[model samples]
Target chain A: MSFEVEDRVAGATERLLGEGTPFTRLGVSEIANAAGIARSTFYVHFADKSDLLLRLAARAMDDLRDALDRWWARRRSGDDRALTECMLRVIDAYRAHATVLAAVGEVAGYDPAVATVWRARVDRYARRLRLELEEDRRRGVIGAGLDVEVAPFVVTWSIERTVAEHVRSSSPTEDRALARALSHFCRSTYA
Target chain B: MSFEVEDRVAGATERLLGEGTPFTRLGVSEIANAAGIARSTFYVHFADKSDLLLRLAARAMDDLRDALDRWWARRRSGDDRALTECMLRVIDAYRAHATVLAAVGEVAGYDPAVATVWRARVDRYARRLRLELEEDRRRGVIGAGLDVEVAPFVVTWSIERTVAEHVRSSSPTEDRALARALSHFCRSTYA
Candidate 1:
């Protein structure tokens, strides 16, 4: 029951953020009201707006990590269709939470705590890519001369920034094409 | 001259943003005072803070475009040193305007006008890369089947996002290595 209420609050926040309302404009009362809960109920689940945002971002991160795992698995299996599916799933997440993510991206600029947390998320993704790149390089699956450290950083940020920009646009590129192209670039660049 | 005052105002805004002061906290009177100008003078130039930011972003975009042009020239001439120099120049511009850019980036989330302008800048950069990629593909420079439309989008966002994140970092990666790695990735990806 607690988790359900928390999910409802999270969903309400995401819906609000997704509407192009500035994160700053989102009040706790509004969120609680939208979630059909008492204002006091919001405080029970989260300390503040930032805390709520952190929880929302954490959920998105988990979904994103799941998508990335699929990418790794499909790529390892050499299944293009599965790889593209994974990419689309990730892109869909970006599209679904475009406003929320954009708000978070904006806050990271001036908010040190947010910036640290955001960078840590990217670093976590990069760490996984680095491990794969190292293994690939050792196995002669990719060029030996590629900068192992930098390659993963670029790949992770490339997809990240690209998707972020895509979601922000009113007319985003077709998802399948973006997925195919992005996956192709990462594969060719690293593999 | 008016231009000199505008530059001072722009510099002050960048400094203020870089100091982690939210744009909402920056008053026009404070801006004018920081620029050593009368509040009236600020109005004589910029209509509002957004106008000042657009000017700042325009300047950064110009410098970025110039650096990209150098990249094209050096790559065509097969001058690795020149290529690295151009990349370093671009990186330096990103670092110098990091705060202004970050502030602009933040505003872009909820402000349709800012978001449109920012995307246009990225689109313009992507357009140039597209044309270049087409020519390169026609000349058998890169693989023929590479997605011409999508490749440049990825490349432009890759550089734009990478540099933006790089500038935001407290412990930024060494400029030279970042330059080399980024240039190498773009060159290899598109050339």
Candidate 2:
């Protein structure tokens, strides 16, 4: 697909997802109409709605990973504030594509390929956290008695679920407060 | 609607959901056919697919609450072993209705009513955990300085996200292991 076509589809996806409509039921013609493109043009870029959905979902996950990596790179050593900011930034990235994330999470059960992609993405994120924890353990900053492998899962799930709830919340202030509280909790417990 | 008709619709809902089709797109006629009833009969019980879905989602949430309550009641104090068992049971209950939970969580964005119901249900569960934590604190089993409200949200979301990832995993044993580790981690940190 040309960059222009991809941009149009991305725009249409953002509009449709933001509308919060029943996305699974969105007709091809409706999307084409919304994109101001011919029905055949839609097929040239994507095979079907499911294909388009997978592409959107993959993009969101990749974007999330990139955001996390960038956040990690900018963090200063032994700086709790920077770590918290990094975590919050990652949460913000997830919030940017909340609708698509929710939709992908929902449809994962029905599509093995999508489920595999979601699982792989989650594992990759968890691995990065695990590496951080391992480094902390090596420095004796984290308790040696703790199981390093399990710590990442615990921390990742805690952050993921908390951020998910925050994203789903209608009140922006409440979400921000929860994010701060969660980041504090994780830092205190782990640091 | 007659009791028998309601039962049939409920039964059909279960069957259709079990088949794992997109819950929002499951047609009234399909449900009616699955129930061996007239296509018009579904209308007698449900105003629309959303109505049926809401009811199913409610029932699933209620079942989860009951299971949690039962598990909590069966436990003797804050024994780590008992807590681990209870957590596993709760995870099992979630696994049984994983599809519905995922569907509801996904569609929550499109429907504020559903999102409200979900938030309330989560709050109720969190409140129960908070009460338990308070009791533990009073008994000197947990730290007094802990933020009781935030802890409940953390624990609830951790278990929920763990079970969700577990249900979606090809190797569910990882989830069980994580749950065990988390049960221990939570107990030790707060104890």
Candidate 3:
């Protein structure tokens, strides 16, 4: 699909999923209606609902990576405010794509393609975290006894879980509190 | 359904899921065939596949809770070895019922019944962790500045994500190592 077409489909998917419908039970006609395209036109861009989901899943990951990259670039100077802002921005991006993230997680084991994308994203994030930790260690911000491998896993998994909980919770304030607590924990645990 | 019939169907469901065959695609018929029961007999016990899943999800939670309870009881006096054993046992129980747990998680948002069961189980576990944390706080074993609510969520979600990663990993040794590292992280974080 062309970039414009893919962007349109992705926008429609975000709206549809944000409406909180069961994606598995959604039909082509529904997606077409949601996208403001003819049912026949839907087939021109995708094979079926699953195909659309696969595309959307890929898009979500790419969008997430882009967000992270932007955050990393914007925070290259490593000020505390920059770091906190970047982390919160990343969390917000995840929240915006929460439904798709949850679906991708659910199917990670059953779908090889999805699992590969998911694992690759996780590994990339882990590497980024490892680099950050190594920098901190070199600067004597963190204890020398920190195990490099385990620290990354802990940070990645902890951040992921914190975001997942925030997305699933009903209260926005709770999520804010959670993000603050997690940011503090991350700094304290590592530093 | 009679108690005996429910028990029989539950056993059959457990067996079919444990096998993890392509027959999963055929749904209830495959389960019926594996159980040596007729389709009508299957329906007599479960209203539908979701009903069967509800039973299985409940059973998985109960089994996990029982295992944890037994482990906790055995370690009521508290020792490092007992703590390690309890953590491993919990991870093992999660691995044993991963499929059902995954299914429950997938359907949770769409199905109120399934969501209720899942939330209840998670809440129960969280409550247990809270009690333990409270005891530790009273004993001055953990830091005074800890946020009580956030601590349990962190510990619970961390262990959960660790077990999930362990189940998805190809190497058993890596899984064990991750589990051990997670247990260690929990000890230090909580302490």
Candidate 4:
């Protein structure tokens, strides 16, 4: 029953944000109304809107992680085309969840809870990515002096910022071209 | 006389932000006291705190552009170490203005003027960087499939976000190593 209310609230939050409602203007009462619950129920499920945004952001991060995992697996198989394909999937996912991701990004700077959640997710992804790169370095697939320690930070930020901008703005380049360029750049830089 | 007032106000803003005063809590009176000016004088030089931050952010962007310009020249001259040196200089500037930049970034999400100013600055940088990459591609220095149209967006974002995080975080990576890695990544991926 609790999970059901949380789901409704999450759905309502996404709908409100999708309709261009800024978080500050989004009141608890409105959220509860949209979710067809009492305002008190919102408190039961979420401390505040920021708390709810964190939940949504966490969902987005999970989707992102799934995309990265696929890329890692294909990359481990030594398929030359893996990176390009991986990037395409990632971009599609970004498009799919652009609204929620955009809201999370806007709120992340000032909202402590959202910022904490966002940073934790990025750190988790970076740590996992670093481990993979270290393995590649050990196997001699990737070259030395690549700063495996720091390269993952650069890689993840680059990909995230680029895709976010693409989704938010009017993109000139097509999907395949972007994926190809990113894949080529990553492969050449690391390997 | 006017320039002096503006300078003092700018300095005061930086100090306040550096001391961890959130923009929401900063007021005209506090700024006047810090700058040793009357509240009326503060009005003459700027509209509000957000306007003051835009000026500061503009200053930071200029410093960043200067660093990138030097890097571009060295890269064109085929000076192998240019990127590392350029990135180090950029990182130093970021550190110097870390507090103000952080403030600008935080307020930018909700402040329309600041957001507009920040986006314009990024767009200017990206456009310049794109022209340089196109020139390289035309000369066959950079390969053709680089997605010159989209690569600059990625490159500028990568450098900006990476440096910003490095300045804002308790970084485990050494300065020289980080510079080397980023320089290597940019060189290998683009040139």
Best by TM-score: 4
Look at candidate 1 and give me any clashing residue pairs: none
Model 3, which residues run further than 4 Å from truth? A1-8, A66-85, A131-147, A188-191, B1-12, B19-26, B67-82, B138-141
How big is the positional error of residue B93 in model 2, measured in Å on the Cα after superposition? 2.8
Query: For model 1, what is the error of residue B130's alpha carbon versus the real structure, in angstroms, after optimal superposition?
Result: 1.0
**TM-score of candidate 2 versus the correct structure, residues matched by position:** 0.78
- Estimate, for each residue in A13-47, the C-alpha lDDT of model 3 and write its tens digit: 76787777656545677877877778888888887
Pairs that collide in candidate 4 are none
Instruction: Give the 10-residue window scoring lowest on summed lDDT in candidate 1 chain A.
Output: A165-174
Q: Which stretches of candidate 4 lie over 4 Å from their true place?
A: A1-5, A24-41, A171-173, B1-6, B21-45, B171-173
lDDT at position A44, candidate 3: 86
Candidate 3 clashing pairs?
none
Candidate 2 local lDDT, residue A153: 68
C-alpha lDDT of all candidate models, in order: 0.78, 0.71, 0.67, 0.78
Q: Every model's DockQ, to 2 decimals?
A: 0.54, 0.34, 0.35, 0.56
Cα lDDT tens digits for candidate 1, B1-191:
45899989988887777677867568999889988999999999998777887887888778778877777767665566778788888888777767776767777765667778988887998898788878877887776546888888888989888887777663555777778778777666642
What C-alpha lDDT, on a 0 to 100 scale, does residue B149 get in candidate 1? 81
Q: After the best TM-score superposition of candidate 2, give how far the Cα of residue B51 lies from its true spot, in angstroms.
A: 2.7
- lDDT per residue (tens digit) for residues A1-191 in model 4: 56999999999988987786666557899989999999998998888888888788877878988997787677666565777888889988887788788777677766666777887877887888899989888988887768888888878877777787777775535776777767766777555
Candidate number that wins on TM-score, 1 or 3: 1
Model 3's DockQ score: 0.35
Worst 10 residues of 3 chain A by lDDT: A182-191
Return the candidate ranking by TM-score, descending.
4, 1, 3, 2
Candidate 1 docking category?
A: medium
Location of the lowest summed lDDT over 10 successive residues in candidate 2 chain B: B168-177
TM-score for chain A of every candidate model?
0.84, 0.83, 0.75, 0.87
